[model samples]
Target: MSRFASTLPIASRAIPNYTTSEAGNPFVDGWYADPDTEIYNGLYWVFPTSSYSYDKQLYLDAFSSPDLVHWTKYPNILTTADISWAVKAVWAPAPISRNGKYYLYFGANDIREDGNMEGGIGVAVSDKPEGPYVDAIGSPLIGEYHNGAQPIDQDVFIDDDGQAYIYYGGHSRANVAKLNEDMISIGTFDDGTQFKEITPENYVEGSQMIKRHGIYYFMWSEGTWTGPDYSVSYAMSDSPTGPFNRLAKILQQDSAVAKGSGHHGVIHIPDTDIWYIVYHRRPLSETDGDHRVLAYDRMYFNDDGTIAPVKMLVKDNFADGQMYSWKTYDGQWTVEDERLTVAETAEAKAMLDTDFADLVFEATASIDYGLGDAGLVFRATNLSTSCDEFQGYYAAITSSDRVVLEKINGGKRTTLGEVDNMIELKTEHLIRVTATGYDIKVFVDDLTYSKISVTERSYSHGATGVGARNTAAKFGHVSVQRP
Candidate 1:
């Protein structure tokens, strides 16, 4: 039997409730990817790819946090407007502060060939960390494919010796080169080689390097970026330009959390061994190609120097006064009074923008006044504003004092289970739902026994949400967990 299997239903253990003070996954809002994290002026900074269609990804934004839990966004820190040669698709910014100047290195135009195409990697300079940076070099610094590697996803690392090096590539290839003191041109090696191929095993793209305890850790992303298999892997060596032997995968997709977790950056705290992995992942709630969000988690290394698998967490307490955590389908959803409230509408839904396969969802729900029902929805996809237009499952408490479990697919609704007259209108009641594989269980105020239980396998993975059909509802103390 699976570890989560049980013969009898029971109350779920308390899941951690996130507050404004607590850090959570996908910490920043909007679609972002290829995050590069750094510390400047004693504050944490994150630069990410504006995840949109290549045509629309013409600008870059940044976020700064005094503490990791709270982040302040600086919009349009750099844009194609500042680089006359950079037309579109500017991304994967690597920012470094040196000699009182902040230098931002980025890739642009998805330059596919070595011809006269004016896109590859370029550098921009700003006096401040967040800035209207101007192009340092009027043209692409490394404009052509070197060592069969596409010149993109550049990462800049300054070693203890103060020598700066850049690692970059795409198309299953990787390369490394030294950055000149100007931070705009490539420096040659003692033997006069300007660029060297350092592609390690299973390497696809997104090169990053860091040194700890005199060991150099070279990491990169593997697998297709658009798929769930996209993940981060690493290899270690004594030399920065290394014949890296593959170690193992470290960060990956969690079906119960998110997918396409890759193209990451590492943050090493000053004067401490602490490290954080900042990356991007696609939420289950969204199906767009550019629907990726920036997230971070603590990274740990075993005594043997191998990295442990990263843990994923997603939570929203509605404390930030921002509705970044949910994508509302229909309704006036607001975060007020420390709860998610939906004003009365014929049929409206707001889905948590995170994906999950098997999860335990719990929340305190209350209805104001209406004959309509309000409750929790799970395993949902293809959501719409119209009534019964999504594919998923929901267990709701009707104002008529009944509990209903139903499945929705292709605008069709199927009743799975129901309990009559078990709840009182306008009163707060705990509503909990668990879905494991094909088995699902719902509990009302009482948890000793499931009010409704059923086994169905129509959908295996999707988003979770709260919905109200013709009623105003308030959901508070909400929690979702993987079991």
Candidate 2:
């Protein structure tokens, strides 16, 4: 049985829908959802960004969620025009309190028409937790020094000695720097105060620094955040600034869910002493770098302060009011050997089927069968009069170690895209297929596989069932809906 077997019913509802604005943009891509949330004035605030343009220009928006599931946006917080040099993206704002004032540090980059490092760290200040945060004088606290390049994704940490340090950088490298007493500017040490750099390079970014039991823990997101490689890694430092040692991976690619987890934040529950890591995952339909959703997992620290490996769902404890229901399947179905299977058969049934729109399907194998195939199907429509004419949407793991979305058109099967070493049978896997018009999105486990265009013969209504080709597979908990 999978570790997440009992926790299968917890579902996350969408908080912030896609929005458009002339001045501010809704987060369409990567955004920070810190797990280590700060509670001020009876509200929990989350600082995130909408990286709309390439120069990485973003607005640090504040959201308050009483229950963590439902969130409301704070209209006024940090805006781009507050700082002059922060022209492009303003992201990952980490705030700390010192001397009765709140210090907000973030990552920013100047507009570069060509590919180059125009990124740096910016700081803002406000008297209250929720604020009209204003940039300090001569903003861009840590910029490309003397015609060098800039640093991005700045996180501020204040140690026990009342000293403050900044950690930032992304795109394979991370750097740490010290801050002056005012908590705005960088303070240089002997080597010009470039604290330390993270190593074992593997696309490390989103650095969040925390201190516990005399150990400085550095957590970061590694791998391509939108691709199959996305995950989280960490390191340890004796002092606030390293010579830090790379520890181990806290999260990684789970073939069962097709998830690439990265760009995380840690939250410690004061009452329970429970630690939670908040991160984002690409939806199953995400083939490239486009859409993503936020998720949270309980985290724990080992005896030595190193983080334990993360599981997709927690099995021991259940959240309050959490319930489970099966996702209905959408596709032609079949049953054999006590196993339910969904497959594409040659039949000129419905040209466009949207009836099975919002559904979840559980794909499992009966008795460990090698080279077995099964998954959820959606956005299906017949393309031609002949039974061979079939084209719609479906993401399935072939018996061949490949996870892909099958776009079938008139007997022609086009594998939209595939992520290798990312699919395993025998264990029950959660599959979510979302279809809107001709746009079809498929996600396995919690990771996205692909988003394909099936406008040619898109299905408006169709029936869904399970079947197996060569091996027997079990299908259950099929639920469908429209979100």
TM-score against native, each model: 0.80, 0.57
After the best TM-score superposition of candidate 1, give how far the Cα of residue 249 lies from its true spot, in angstroms: 2.7
Writing each residue's lDDT as its tens digit, candidate 2 over 148-258 gives: 223665677778887788777765666777788988766887776455555434536778887777778887777775678878877777877676667788887544332
Candidate 1, RMSD to the unseen true structure: 8.3
Candidate 1 per-residue lDDT, tens place, 243-291, comes to 8888999999877677899999887766656678889998765688688
- Please name the candidate that would achieve the greatest lDDT relative to the true structure: 1
Global local distance difference test of model 2: 0.55
Q: Give the TM-score of candidate 2.
A: 0.57
Q: lDDT at 320 for candidate 1?
A: 49
Number of clashes found in candidate 1: 0
